[model samples]
Target: MKKTRKLIYLLEDNDDIREIIAFLLTEQNYDVCAYPTVKSFNEDIVLGKPDMFVLDVMLTDGNGIDVCDSLKSNQKTHHIPILMMSANTQMFTVKEKCDAEDFISKPFDIDDFVKRIHHYMD
Candidate 1:
C-alpha cells in the first residue's frame, strides 16, 4: 500500500506568500491545497477535511479568527490543528480568541515555520 501524504489547507491572500508557502510545504513532502482568500477555503472545506490548516489572520473577504472559530465549533473539523499567521503584534490575543493550535508571525523564519507545522502534525 502506498502511504498517503498529509493534506494541508492554506488560506493566504498575498500571492507571493501563498506561492512560497506552497513550495516550501511541497518540498517538505506534504500535500498543500492553497487558496487566495477565505471564500475559496470555504468552498473547498465541504469537499473534504484537510489534516491541518494554516490560516492568515487578515483575509480579503473575512478574518481568519472567525474561520478558526467556526472550524473549532464544528464537530467534523474541530480536532484539526490550526496555525494562525499574522503580522500583528497582538497575535497571541487573537490566538486566544480562536481555536488555533499555534501561530506564526509574518516575516517569519522559513525554518521555524516548517518546524511549527511539524509540531502540529506530530
Candidate 2:
C-alpha cells in the first residue's frame, strides 16, 4: 500500500524562508501549505487543518505566539503539534507564552530542524 503524505501548514512572513521551508518539507515527502501572513493562514485554515503547524514568532500582521495559543486552545486544532520558530524572541519566552510541541531559534541547524519535524511527524 502507498503511504499517505502528511500535511503541514507553515506560517512565515519572509518570502525566501517560506519558500525554503516549503521546499525542505516537500523534499521530505510532506505536503506543505505555506502562508505569508496571519490573514492568509486564517483564510486557509478554515478549509481544513493540517497534521502539524509550523509558525513564526513574529509576523507583520500578527504574533505567532498568539496564533499558537489560539490553536492550542481550540478544540478543532489543539491536538496538532506546533513548532514555533523565531529569530527575534527567546525560545524560553516562546515556550512560556504558548504550548508549542517544540521550539527552534532562527538560524537553526538544518539537521536539528528536520529532526524536530520528524519527531512530530514520525
Instruction: Give the Cα RMSD of candidate 2.
Output: 0.9
Candidate 2 lDDT over residue span 46-112, tens digit each: 8976999999999999999999999999999999999999996478878999999999989889889
Q: What TM-score would each prediction reach against the true structure?
A: 0.96, 0.97
**Full-model lDDT for every candidate:** 0.93, 0.94
lDDT top scorer: 2
After TM-score superposition, the amount by which residue 117's alpha carbon in candidate 1 deviates from its true location, in angstroms, is: 0.7
Model 2 clash count equals 0
Candidate 1 Cα lDDT to native = 0.93
Model 2 error, position 67 (Å): 0.5
Q: What is the lDDT of residue 121 in candidate 1?
A: 76
Residue 93's lDDT within candidate 2 is 78
Candidate 1 local lDDT, 1-122, one digit each (tens): 99889999999999999999999999988999999988899999999869999999999899999999999999999999999999996876996899789988898999999999998876
Superposition error at 37 for model 2 (Å):
0.4
In TM-score terms, candidate 2 sits at 0.97
Clashes of each: 0, 0
